[model samples]
Each structure stands twice: as C-alpha cells, then as structure tokens.
Target: MTDSQRTALIDHDVWNGGLFGGADGRWYAADQTRDVIEPATGERLTNIGVARAADVARAAKAAAAAQPAWAALAPRERAAVLRRAAAALERNLEDAARYIARETGGILAKAQLEVAEAATQLHIAAALPLQPQGLLLPSTAGRTSYARRVAHGVVGVISPFNFPLILSMRSVAPALAMGNAVVLKPDPQTPVSGGFLIARAFEEAGLPPGVLQVVPGDADAGAAVVEAPEVRMIAFTGSTAAGRKVGELAGRLLKKVSLELGGKNTLIVLEDADLDVAASNAAFGAFFHQGQICMATGRIVAHRKIAAELTRRLIDKAQTLPVGDPASGTVAIGPLINERQLRGVDAIVRASIEAGAVLEAGGTFERLFYKPTVLSNVQPGMRAFDEEIFGPVAVITPFDSDDEAVELANRTEYGLACAVIGASVARASAIGERLKCGLLHINGQTIADECVNPFGGRGDSGNGGSMGGPADPDEYTQWQWVTVKSTAERTPF
Candidate 1:
C-alpha cells in the first residue's frame, strides 16, 4: 500500500499488536496502543503502536531474508541513496528540527544541531562506501592475501528518548551503508514524527523497501526485537538494567550485540581552572535538557581553593536558565521527558538531602520544567551521588588534591565520559589519565558531536558501542576474506 513517495512495509494483519498508523496509503495499527505527551506540558500528542512479540519476529525474519540481496549491492550504490537522503534532509531542515524539538522537548538550537548532524551523518556514511579495509597476509606472499569488511546482515537498533533523531540515525545510517537491513525501534514517546519522516525521506531518496523498518512500541516490542534469531546483531542504548536483558537475549540468539547504557559522569575542576569558564561549562552540562542526558555532569569534584567561587557562580547561572517551550528560541532549557523521569529525579535528590547533603539552589522546582538543582556536601553513599540521576540536578563536592578527585570521580560503576577543567594542559592531561571513562574531555565539556568523537565506554560505562565518530561505522560491520589462484599455479593441489 506504499506510494512512490515513501517506502512502507507491514506485518501480517492477523498480527495486529497494540499500535497502528497509515501513511502513503498503507495502514498499520496495533490492537493496543499508548498515547504520547509533551514532557514540558502534559498534553497528549498522539498514540504509538505497542508491538506484539509476533511483530518483532516478523520484522526480524524480513530483515534476515532481505539481507543477501542488499549485501550484494555495490557499496557505492548504497552510498548514492544515502547521498540522496542527506540531500532530502538538507531541503527540509526546519521541519525536521521542529519535529525533534516538539517530540523530545529538545531546545530549538540543540534540535537543529541534531538535524544538521543527521544530514552530515548521512553524507559521512555515504562517503564511507569504499572504505572496507583489506590487509595483505604474510601467509600468501605471491598473491594479495587480505580480508574485506562486509555486512553482518540484519542489525536491530533500539534508541532512547533523549536523542531520538540522532541516535536512531546513528544506528540506521551505518547499517544501511554497509548493506545491512535494520530493525529500528525508537522510544515510544517520540516515535511517530522525526523517525517516521526519516524513513519517508530516505525512501523518496531512492532507498528500497525493507531496508529501514520502524516498529513503534514499548518494552515488549524491544524484547521481541532482541530475541529474534533472524536478527544478526543488536545495537541498543538505554538503561543498564535493560541492556543486561538485551545482552542476554542476543547471547541466546548467538548474535553480535553492542550496547551503550547508563552513565554517572564527573566534571573535574582543578584550582588552576578558569573559575568563570569552568562554572559556565558545569552549569550547562548539568542543566541542559533538564539534566536528562547520560553525559550530564551529575557529579563535580572542584579543587578546594576555587570550589566556593565556582559553586556560587554555577548556582547563579543555573537559576537563570530559561525553562519553557521547546520551539521558542529564547528558552535554553526544557522539561523532563515524562513524569516518571521527573519523579526519579526528585526521589534521588530528596534521598541525598535526607542523607546529609545540602540542597543549594532550585533543588526541586515544581513546574514541569524541573528547576536546575545544584547540591553540595554530597558523598558516595547516596543514590543521588552514586547512581545515574538523569535530571538537571548536580552534586558538587570539593577535593584538596588531584588524587582524591580522580579517585572519587572513578568510583562510579558507570564510566561513559568525564571532563577536566583547568587553566593549564598538564592538569587536564593528568586528570584525564587517572579518570576511568570511555571518553574524557580536557579544558571544556559538552555532551557529544558526531563528527569529532565516536563514543562508547569502559567498565560499566558502555559496551564499546560507537554510535558515531572515530570507530568508523564503515568498519564497525562484520568482514570476510577471499583468495584466488590461477589454474596454472594450482598444479600441486
């Protein structure tokens, strides 16, 4: 029922799960569905399908059966379609950015940046068409003995709410460029618009059917996606608890799996740090997106000498951050994605205060726009201090020495990313070396950019899943090796 303008696929009508939609003459709906709401405001936006176990199995099987023909296409040919898709995105950046902000409660600038990244990422993935590497082996001196990177077939990708557009693209683009069909499942809250548009645009840009299928649903669909045997690989990003489940299922299926899970990151500010600069960085990192980001600076270890001044400035700045509508250009911060996460933030901070921490500023704002909270006197024992409190609250404590700061920073189970703020390069480098994190930033700190760093983690930080950046998605794929000898040269055999 798909039209020429968009590529659409469906599960068998008998398998109607809990979600359904119609686009370009194709109708899809589940028997049960959940409504989506704007986190900043509790108004219902739309309903999303909550897929049944059967739907996941169907998508997985389809992806597997289509893999071979897809893999056989010239990499450059696949890249061309990606180029077209990128071109399509550039033509509609404004609408796409708006959709992302509205659905995910992302600020306009940040959402636009995401849209820009999506376009650039499409091109980046497109450019990697011929990058499959081959090495000359010592075992065959007379012939070119080497291996080639190839598709791993069907890769199941599950995304989170924070970066719905970008993360989903991060998973889909590379998988597509490498000739692998994808089973993409976005967070139920923001599923319909941004991702649905991407699928539509790519199809218009000449992508084939069954390449990037979107199955919108909740955890049950996620489980279905991971457990299917036809799924060749699983790329997931979310909480650690959920990641454990996904990993186990992938193991049972004997498939390749990559996970990017929870993070409890730290920002180290030494005495030599620029107080004003460090304060500004800390405020933004801890409060932007209402501090729901995984790399949000949840903990801060400031040098005792500058701790008081830096803390004061950070408090002042955080208090002033604009919290309102996502579409408004003036608003610098937005609401939590949902009430559940909002309650989670409150519970963590409340326990920390009860357990002997001081609530500095705006510790618990009543509005949907959770106030930017900064806590001092926090220690390792409290859940607010120990776990990933994905909210706009930050816990700051002073450290007299670099060793104490590094030790305290590295104490968490999650080591996704860290930041070192200091005036000189030596301090930054020293702290970076001692901090146990997958990605460490020196001098300045920010969430992430798809261009500069391909991200993952050590310890429980991440399971070496690179969404974008240096890991080279072109190379992230599975590989194959082959050799050929002339008939005249094969006499002995």
Candidate 2:
C-alpha cells in the first residue's frame, strides 16, 4: 500500500492484504470494514477489515493446531525469536510511535514511550523461558516425581485503545515465550498500532505461521475469543464493566483469565510537602495522556493547611498545558479517543459542578480537545470524586487529618493505584500502607510501571490476577505432575 493510502500514518508496505491475519499465513478478507478515524483531526485515516465471531474462531483453531510444535522447540530457540522481535520493534520505533500518536491522539512522547515499553516487554519475556519452570517432589523408592509448567495451548488477548502497544504486547510476548500460540483481538479504534504492528514484528523475526494471529473487531469478536473452545486462557485490559463480563464468561467456560481493569487512583499531598513538587506531580498524574490512563489520578487528597495554595498552583499548571493535535509534537494534552468519551468526561465535570464542586481552571473543549480542568472542594459523594473520569480533569479534596486522608482515598470501590507525597518517605509509606490499592507510590505519582513488577489491581479493578514479572509463568501455563518408576510394581489386580 502507498503512504497516501494509509493517510501517511506510517511508511510500511505490509498491509497490502486484509487487516485480519488468519491462520493460513494470509490476511483474510472480511465482508465488513471499519473506518479508522484520527481522533485529533476527525478524519478517516484508513479502513480495515472487521472480524466477526466466525473469524475469531478460525484464528483460535489455527493457534491450537500450531501450539504443540512451537512448544516442542528448545527454550533458547524461543528466546532468540523473542529477542529478534524486540530488535525489529526498536528498528522501526519512530514510525511506530508516529502511527500510535496519529491513531490514538496521544502526544508523540507518550507514544514513543509506549513503543519503547513494548520492546522492553519483549526483552523481558525473552528471559522467561530460561528461568526455572518446575519443582522436584518427594517420591517413594524406585520412583521419581516432579511438577512442571506446561503451555495452555492457546491464549486470547483483548487490548484497549489507550496505551495499545504496551498493553497488548505485555500479554502477547510472554504467552509466546512460554510456548503458547496467541490470537489477539485489539480494539477496533487502534487496529494498526495495537495489532498489525505486533504481527509485522513477529513475522519479520521469522515466527512460524499460525503461532500468532491478529484479529481486530468490536464486542462480538471479543465474545467469540472468550467462547472459542480451542482457547484455554484470556488476558483482557479494559473497563471494569467490560472486564466483569469477560471474567464471568471465561469462568463459566473454565478458562484461565487475567483481567487488568479500571481504576479511580488517588494522589495524597501532605502538609509538609513542597508545594512546587506536589503541584508538578499532580499535573503529570492527572493530565498525562489527557488523563486516559487507568492509573491516572482520579482524585487528589491534600492536607487542609496547604490545600488552597496547592490548588492555586495546580490551576496555574492546568492553564498552561497546551491542548491540540498530538501529531504536531508540541501539545502536552491531546484529544480524547472519540466523541463518546468526550461526552462522558464533560458530563462528569458538569455534574460535579452542580454538586457544589468549584471549577477553578477549565470546563471547556474545542472539538475533541478537552482542556486540562481543575475542580476544588470535591467530596467523597460527588461524581467527580466517585466516578472514573478518564479525561484531563483533576479534582482536589481537602482532609483534616491523616486518618481522614486514608478514608477519603479508600472511599471508592475501585483500588488500582495510589500515591503519597510527603517531606519524609517513611512517613508517606506508612500512610500509603493504610490505603487499599494494588500499586502504591511514595514521593511520586500514581502512573508508574516497570517490566519487572507485577501489575494489576483489587476490588472492582481486577480479580487478583496480575501480569509481568513473576506472574507470567502462572498466568500463561498450567501445572502438570509427572511420576516414573525404575521398576515395575507388583499388580494388586
């Protein structure tokens, strides 16, 4: 395809066939095609094939058929393939980042970081196969017994539009490393960056056919992946509402599931904190990526003594953040993914204001570009404090004491991440320990992740299943117990 055909999102020629990669080493055509709209410009960037339930089923069957052979390879062989894939991603990093920025309305820097993180995830997954995969068990005389981790045959990954590259690869690379085939269904809004780019990298790395398939679609496609008989596990990243449905269906089918869901993360600023540092962290935490992150600070709990001054500084910061097309590589804040998301965010801000929260900085937008907004006097019962407004809006609520700060932080049902800013790290950590969240940050912001850390949430956020680091083996494989005898035992029969 020509550059103009793809709307100049990237300079690549691999998308000549259908968008959906099938099991037969060919891109399969579909009856339907969906338009990929650029969030910043509201223009059709490109159109790609849309996979339905039947298409997803075909991919799953192919993955199941191809898994055994792939798993039979030596560990080093698999690791080498993963390392090569990582290198391929690094080689095309700039193009991929530009594609991501144009497609998702994320700034260039965020897109670049996401692509880099995806490569890092591949590198991390490369090392997983070389690690220990089993344990020896006690056995009787003339008998040997052990337990080993074995592939689950096929894994289905459903990724969201926000941070598409990293979220999808975090599951895909690890599953492939553990010797399982994957059928990935990236969000329709970001098919190229979330699915096509991944397929290209692995294909260039010489991965065998049918071992990985990329199928982009909407809810029907996702449901098909969960229901496919050939798939043994599901890794999903999206809203808590969607995640609940995925978990319920996967559970009924007895499929292993890893869910990384929604969050209403909190950032607490103590009375002794440096106002300048606290304000900067607050801006980054609440406004980064237009506040589309699951770990974005939904609410800021500040000590009453410094609440007014902190709010003033936050307003100044919010007013200065430039909002526009991210493709220009100048704006700090970009548009929301779509019109529906923009409406949802606007509704929350209006309702919170109606409930007595003061809109201090911004409460407006031009097209999909929402201004970085600030609201003070927010309380626990208000929508601004209770709901997950996945937009560039920061709500501040003051607390009289440390106990009250912890109470306010833990008020919501969702508990994904929380941050505490204080003069002393030890004191902040002590306060953080009292809050309910899967990830906690001291003297930092809530938005943070490393390749070596287990990532997930609790309560409405997740079902205790995590990704990355030590959780990979358990999440991608099933345990099998084996026993052997040196001599035949006497038959009781």
Candidate 2 local accuracy as lDDT? Answer: 0.91
Identify the candidate with maximal TM-score.
Answer: 2
Tens digits of per-residue lDDT, candidate 1, 1-493, equal 1445432321123222333222221225666677777766677666666667787777677667767877788878888889888877776778777767878888988888887888888888887777745565656555655677777888888988897877788778888887888888888877754356566567667676666667877789899888877777888888888998888888887888888888888999999878888988888888878787778888888888888888899889877887788877789878888778888889998999999998888766666678888898888898878988889887898899888999999888888889998888986898799888887889877465545467787667667666676575543577577775543373665
lDDT of each: 0.76, 0.91
Looking at model 2, residue 47 earns an lDDT score of 75
Stretches off by above 4 angstroms in model 1 are 1-27, 141-144, 474-476, 488-493
Among all windows of 10 consecutive residues in model 2, the one with the lowest summed lDDT is 1-10
